[model samples]
Target: MSKKNRKFLATTVTAAAVAAVLAPSVSADELKFTDVSDTYADAVNFLVGNGITKGVEDTKFGTHQNITRVDAAVLVARALGFDENGKYKDAGFTDVPDRAKWAVNALVQNNVVDGLSTTKFGSYDNLTRGQTAKLLANAAKLPVNDGVTKTKFTDVNENFAKYVDALVREGVTKGKEETKFGANDAVKRGELALFLDRAKEHFGFFDLFVMHTNDTHAKADMGPKRATAVKELRSEHKNNLLVDAGDVFSGTLYFNEFQGAADLQMMNYMGYDAMTFGNHEFDLGSSEEGHKALASFVKNAKFPMLSANLDFSKDELFIGLQNNRYTSDYSNGIYDGIVVDVNGEEVGIFGLTTEETPTISSTGEVQFANYVEKAKEAVAAFEARGVDKIIALTHLGYNDSLNFDNDLELAKKVEGIDIIVGGHTHSELKDPVVSNEFDAPTIIVQAGTQSKYLGTLNAVFNEDGVVTSFGGELVKVGDFEADAKAEEILAPYKKKVDELMNQSTGVSTEVALDGGRDSNNEGNSSVRHNETNLGNLITDGMLATAKTINDKTTIAMQNGGGIRASIDEGDITVGEVMTVLPFGNALAIMELKGSEIKAALEHSVSADLRDDKTGLKESGAFLHVSGLKFEYDSSKPAGERVTKVEVSEGDKFVALDDAKTYFVATNTFTAAGGDGYDMFGKAYADGRVSEPGNVDYQMFIDYLNVLDKVAPAVEGRIVDVNPAAAKTVAE
Candidate 1:
């Protein structure tokens, strides 16, 4: 990734603090297991009434006692129901002193313990404040300290650093002073009562908060400040949502560990509502196995895996991937959309992957269809079921030129879709890019790549199901304090990823990437418009990697959108590279007649369907490419916009003939004529490639990191062919 990109990703670290107090309730209900004479009656009653803690004996309420480490574990495990699994039956520990045997087995079986020095359980050891905080926070599944970033405790140094800060954030623990954690202090039974009480308050309420982390690319651990940031969001938002926008497969060596199983588990613990699959979801190298692993990972999903475009009717992998494994359980997608009653309002969500599956997905036996067609069908289905307040989860990128009117067009054409919470392109829309698709307007958003930013949207819907007013922003992952609960959930993965991301790659001259549009005199900027050494390096890598299969390959064309990220000028790591190129999109070379190529060129120049409603600069796929050069005048009418065209051979521009056939390399999206490149569609209605992976964003970073300095300047690769003097070319 570029230094600017890394800096951009790192900019989210500003932490904010909020005060959270345990709200009280009035109830005189008798405690079933406790007598009125119990010394801990008030504390126990308060906890039991709020559903926080329960009694262990018929008449004895252990209140003033210093709870044993074993006792604390049991209370926490039972409260969270962590001991129900049969997987911990063989759990063995040497230091539990038999008296704490049940607690040791329960904690160990639930993955709540880091091995206590090999075979020892350390049960006889007094639980320090730090240890107690960690255990209670994890058991309650609450944010470490309600997402507070850092505290000012004088005594809490880095040694007890792990729990003091996190526990305080989650409201589970507050150390002795501004500078002291009192790490050796024992947590009394009454103190535990307070922690459990707060957890119960947050859990029992219906207030909902939704969080999402899309296109993970197998990084598994939080990227930069993401883990900390999302955790904070959950704690701050109170009711929360954490989601992945698919593409969780492939990318790093972590996937090699259980084939992306651990990543799914991490996401589950982080609490995802629903995740939409990206093309990379097929990268187990086996569609069936990949599907099975996906199912297995979500075996204990608190949410569902929603995908409406690709029909899994014949796929063995989706045997029972729906909600609750019920035959008619369309609870999430009764109308091709899930209705979530968040804070009392209903939120309708639908999901669709880019229809470019034959080229991008390794479905083995799975078949895919056109996203536009499926989206139309799905939306129609939702409409039929009275779900008008719709949000589409799309994996399609935003292209300025090839405007066959996909998502952007859908934003305008479709009527019910209020927001398009999009993934795939990794384009960061800091503000909602309002789509004039309907009278109500569609709010579209994307949070670049990785877990760098949390996209937030607030829509005010009237009783009519139309968006009355809507606004959204991308919150940098570093801006909020890490949510303690999220931290505890991700702690294991974070450590593992730290070991993986810390290794360096190389450095560069300057920040070398600009992902959006280029506004310079050439219609593209040096940093943004033309392919940088980074884009060239990536495209070149694809060509080099693919040539191992086809020596006959001449020129390769990688869609700009598919080039996910740039290699920043700095130390690079394998994980950073994968983040850029997360998908397994491979290279494909197709045979096209020169006439078909001319048609493709024409489609690109005029692809920007500019009308008064949508300004000239608003065409979705207006950007062109490498290997070819083109010029156009928007002043000219549509179909007559281009004035000249040329292809480069070595360093010289060559005139082209429309009758000859040539080999071209590109991805399945453009090849399928997705952006109104009908000539390509007509020529290769059956066009295809056999490669299973694309270098994606990370490959470009890897390529750049290998080269200490990069020079990414745009060369006039694609030129225009004018209509006024085109007699030299055939009609």
Candidate 2:
């Protein structure tokens, strides 16, 4: 057999043997045996839960009882998947009773133990330390020390010295005392339990449960549900870690009003271990009030905020915030990475935020570095500190191409990361994506956006920290019971949110203004794909608001992603409007050449949808426009997709003049290069754009107030010209 296979067999057999003897057969509630040490309670409970051993009587474990040869044989047999009914050739042993026949036969058949004289099995004899070591070493299939002549143990017989050495080499034992094996001493039940637990750990048979969430987006109401999950999971698994992969800010009226305070309270109450920063975390750092909101979030958070690549030293707002220069303490509030001990095992965890933060959000003076490089450095640092199990908590999207680092790329490039909890693309990964790019396995998982799902990834690793087995699933938070304490914490916040939600804007809609993208005109609606009345209403509001600043403002646009939710057919409230535009972006008016406008349009639909057999669909960058009409052919290349573009000239539509400049209105996020709008960002940087000092949602609210009974309809402002054709768009 190959060396790798041999090693695997050795560890597997050792784990099996240890697990069989020490695995728990009942719950802690049913464990009446009370002699276990407080420090080894979990270990002893594991033994009982796995059904490896049972109490000597109905309510007594006989912790001081001496183990016999037959007792050891029975445990080893059961661990190796053999039972009393398992068929095996009978070993002719005179002394082994019929009750011990199966165990003796199993041991003899498996070549783990033999009879004293090929005919007499000493089944009732008390098992000695050296004899037990020999049996365990043989059962584990450890390599024989054929060349060793010296004995490390003072009292171990020469015949059993090799077995004791093998046991020590495997970390299964270190002898009863420093230099003595106590070769002739009887093995006690407690000593046996300790040995089995150590062997199980040495072979990496222990459980590690990781509970994580991403893109929560200030759904503080779901805090109780998340807390319920964490509490239940922690009870079931002794080794558990709770972490968030960022985007804890924005998305609802709660965030708009409380500005992450409510979320921070809930997170602390739920006992979050660590969290990474998402782009939304920096969304409010540009203005003084916004900066204070972020500062408050950091100050109130009980857990560490991790960002290895971000340089916050230059940012004055973050003064005195603990930076993870060399420490791993979570109380510091800011850290690059941390080494946490879980059930006596060291777990190294680090964070990575997308480098696209500066262009996508208001990061102020904080700068970002390459995610891959930072990840490599973190891994090296952790490894230097003797940490093997590494987890990368990231806000990088699962898969995106805005020059932003993504989870899949990070997993493939960085070798040591065993798990990647990610967010930012709002992807709902039902199952973990396991990538074996290096020698070890890297698991990438993301829960769906908006606290809708909580992801749990349970993994089993070998001694070398390589993932040997793993399984994961997203748990629907709606199915879980909410914690009462969390609900009590959110009661005041909810009361304030309700007041905002109750205020009617008087713009009653007759239909569910479709913001959802239903590309084929099917019932499946999605704002990211097809045009809708809601998109029209939002863009028209921007255009009208911009016109108040500059009469020359002729067109307005908004990325579908910025539109968070759809308004139901009823009286709209300020809360609903806030939820729809929760990013708090201001209106930006810019002067761009007609050619640049067309280029922006081309960039909007540049996402490739042909691979999914859905032509020109489901791109968040899909533009919602007002005061302009355009048609694109999906079969054409990206830059050349826009075949016809027209601008409103009085009551007539005129073809766009390629060289003429026109004033356009959009959200500051889009105008400053959010959603890959490079041309718009450049124009703003070059003094070609001006801020109108109008909050995006306030502009919509104002427009709603102007038109008391608002009704918006799709008027063919944007059209898909090769609508029936299934073709690819050039990258």
Candidate 3:
């Protein structure tokens, strides 16, 4: 039978149920209702409320009687205000006899039912769940959010795709979370109510300040927690916005495997209002194909991409859907800036990225113009166009010291920008740092790299759209409830990464770890300290590895900042090591004059001496070095603290002279004099140094795997100097 006829027939059979509503004066127990008491009760109440159904008599709701197709159609038509107004011929249903002709005509005219065959209507079939949802959704004139692309849902296969898609998108139905939508199941009255409520919420509009995220690096779930804080603020003020700063792309292997497809999906499911690009968005290798892949990854996104800087005019990456582009720079095309409505106020947003694209982005060709200049122009245009409230979605670094050309400088230089939501040098701003250089306060914020932190800024704008008063907080990921939808999206990808990392490598006695110096922030000891066992293990491991490569190589030296994290006591794996040493830098073998080595030693020693955080002075050298021993005088000044230096030739201490050269193994960064090692870095520039592969972490791991149990201990590698007591005060 045709679908129309089946619907018509089902309508006829259910017409009695639809029309009968128990009278308020009568008790439900006395009301004559159907066998499905729960369904009937709800249906009766709803129908009666909506004026679709009425009781058979004062107290009789005749729900049990099988409803004919014609009766169902007439009742439904009456509810829809189609009584006699909607005209229809005597639609011939094979089973519907002439006696019920008016009902059939009414059903057919309302488009709620049709004959089973060209000349017959099956008017006695019961309505199923799938059919019920579709009918209700259509009756309400709801809009379906069927994505422009398809996903992998078993139940949403070809045959019922359209109806299922519409019902699900219109919020009339839901799959059994983590399971397929059972389309064939019988419809329940309770489920129907939920569908209706959801549909209403979907169509009902409310002013919203939406915050969103993308490419959080491996920040492993920080977005959810920060979003919660923002949500709380949103609830209180009823006007707020939160969003992600990007690059959730490549630094971590978790992002490498799924190409961040799962991450982006989670962001979309979390109801993010918008997103901008990060350099890592081009990590998969930016070509037409790579950009296309990224585009596809975000294709399910309901919100649009806002990249005012990228020019995709000639790039195949943006060929077809130019509408996806949104800013003032491009007018004939879709502009990148969006005016988000907040309680009758329009707030404009534009996105910008760092100019370091040429060096950092691995994917498709990226062209970045002067962000500060472009931003100033954009803001001026927004103001001229009468858009007072403005926000810049920036992927600029927060610590300009780390990223020489940072966006914070941009914020300082630009006058009209209200808020600079920044990323890149992932800084965890516990609170918003207000920039007063601009006429109005320019707030700068960033979630630390990896999904570990989320940055939120709250602003109260004046009539001119400049922020008069504002504050922000950085939220830790552990603080909030993980959005269920985000969890669902991440499950598979997380499972895959877990499977890969769970393979055991070695175990530690206990957690021997410390997250080293964070370049993104100002502090050093949090990640870079002499006390961290991680630093000890890494330097020792490098020394051990160098011994294998060069028997003459003594004392492996590793920068404190290079020691990523301590190996916590537990099942260790290759993945953890990779995470600790993601740079893949290589070891460099250098011959340095004794005096120069001593000077290099003085730099770190001094930095550690005056450093209030870690008491590294009592711990010899802050820089983990093997094959060398020295002591320091805690009472002496920094550069003069190292009093004595000794070199060991396998258990023997030897005298060292300033003119003599010692062969040492350390990272190229050090050899090039990074971290105040000007002497070493300058050595390489003078062609007195040699270096190896860019992947240094591999060498450390190889050294570790070979040892049955590597035990690294602190020796008196550095000696302290004290002036032989003054002839003195005693005399």
**Top-TM-score structure, candidate number:** 2
Task: Give candidate 1 regions above 4 Å deviation.
Answer: 1-212, 234-242, 256-258, 285-290, 323-336, 380-386, 400-405, 479-540, 544-553, 556-693, 696-731
Question: Which runs in model 3 stand beyond 4 Å of their true positions?
Answer: 1-215, 220-233, 286-293, 313-315, 321-335, 401-404, 504-572, 575-600, 606-621, 625-638, 642-731
Query: What are the lDDT scores of the predictions, listed in order?
Result: 0.53, 0.76, 0.55
Q: Across residues 372-410, which tens digit of lDDT does each residue of candidate 3 receive?
A: 777776677677677777788877655432233465577
In candidate 3, residue 352 scores what lDDT? Answer: 77
TM-score of each: 0.47, 0.58, 0.49
lDDT value for candidate 3? Answer: 0.55
Across 598-687, the per-residue lDDT of candidate 2 in tens digits comes to 999999878665555446657888899998999887767777888899999899889999899999999766876888999987885565
Q: Rate residue 357 of model 3 by lDDT.
A: 57
Query: What lDDT does candidate 1 reach at residue 399?
Result: 34
Candidate achieving higher TM-score, 2 or 3: 2
> Which candidate model has the greater TM-score, 1 or 3?
3
RMSD of each: 21.3, 15.0, 21.3
